[model samples]
Target: MATIPAKYFIALVPEGKIQEEATALKEEMKNLFNLKYALKSPAHITIKMPFEWNENKEDKLIYKLQKFLAGIGVFDLKFRDFDRFGRRVIFVDVLPSATLQSLQESLGKFCKLELNLINELSDRAFHPHLTISFKDVKPKNFDLYWKHIQSKHFNADYQVRDVALLKRMEGRWKVIHRFPLTEA
Candidate 1:
């Protein structure tokens, strides 16, 4: 018999209304630009980037995450307008926040020390944004997409009450568990 490892990542995923809004934007991106890669996962600001871990050890991983995350205080996030990573990516712009940075840094350190999950992606500066489009958008059409997206408006205030651990299941990502934020 053989076992398949599960691909996992942690993120602060807001509730229904925000997800619906983000999903709609993602759908619009696919329709307008013929790029659908962002549709693979729900809109989220990544806390711990994807890592491979043995499925048999998942319970242990979840337990540690639960313990670590429950001590963190819940915080509010403000997102206003749209921004891009050069021409390659367009996202719902997140306002500058110190609390968000602290949460991510704490989670990153915990993942490294406790879960032994080291992600090269996380090594980069933490920029929190709910992506609307990335990678699949053709370079030539970038200006067009940017022009189109700029015409669209997205702004919201969301509270982070819990963090989700998602597994890359089947073909797309699915939330397997949520660890709530508790004031320390």
Candidate 2:
């Protein structure tokens, strides 16, 4: 029998205080989303998402990551507030900033040119966000969920020093590599 393929997601994880606030926010989201399972650790702003890859491909992916990250430098990021996306997904919207927009666009291009992962779910044109809660919620519950989430607010900010490669294994996500975005 063929094994179920593992998935990998790359993200820019916030360090220190912001990480803590985001963690707390996850609790709020869990309740609002009426989640069935526990949330994952290392709350972050994703740059790339679930892609099929083998364990042996780590080094090559890292190399590609390094090359793509070259010329790109560290930038600040702020997790402004919580907002639900059509009731199915919950995310913290990031306030627009040029640094953030450039980074997202560049990464989107690199993911296309280097990794060849197609399927653009979001605008690479705008700054991206950190997903706090997601579930396959029933349509009837959508308004109930959004109304609950509407009253809550999340305001956390942090400098984005590094981005990471996270791989899912044995039913959990693990950070495989963290590449720093150096000062220009």
Candidate 3:
């Protein structure tokens, strides 16, 4: 018998007002533009890109992540308006914070050294943003959507107290574990 590998990623899932605002924006994208793929998962900033591993080794991976997060402290995050990667994707802009950058870098190093998961995408550079809509937005509609929401305003500030381990199951990504940042 063969085992199927499971996919996982680490992310900061927004809470309270930030989550609500991001959810509302996703709803607007669905209703107005008929784009909804980003809604498949909750709003978050990807600290580590998706990586695959055997199901049997999941416990070890989780243990490593817990240890890594235990050394991190809660950090403040702020979002404002909208931004995009060319015309292909649109997202809520996350202001660059040294704390966020440092956390991402440390996660990349830890994943490589501890889990043997070397994520080139996350390792190369990190552009932290909360996606609003992508993958489903057609090229023709990209401009129209971008233009319509370009100037729309949204502001949210929240503390990232924990990191979530989301696993792809049956095709949907769901939060399987949460490791809180414990250090001051």
Each prediction's number of clashing residue pairs: 0, 0, 0
Task: Give the alpha carbon lDDT tens digit for every residue of 1-184 in model 3.
Answer: 3666889999999778788888888899899999989988989999889999788878888888898888788889889889998878899999989999999998888888888887685556799999999999898888889987875787888788899999988777889999988756
Candidate 2: segments with Cα more than 4 A from true spot:
1-5, 29-33, 36-38, 123-127
For model 1, give the 10-residue run with minimal summed lDDT: 116-125
Deviation (Å) of 82 in candidate 2: 1.9
- lDDT (CA) per prediction: 0.87, 0.71, 0.87
- TM-scores, in order shown? 0.94, 0.82, 0.94
Give the total clashing residue pairs for model 3.
0
Q: For model 1, which pairs clash?
A: none
Supply candidate 1's per-residue lDDT for 142: 93
Kindly report which residue stretches of model 3 are placed more than 4 angstroms away from their true locations once superposed. Answer: none
For candidate 1, write residues 31-120 as lDDT tens digits: 877889999999998878889988988898899988887778888899898999987889998998899888888888887888777746
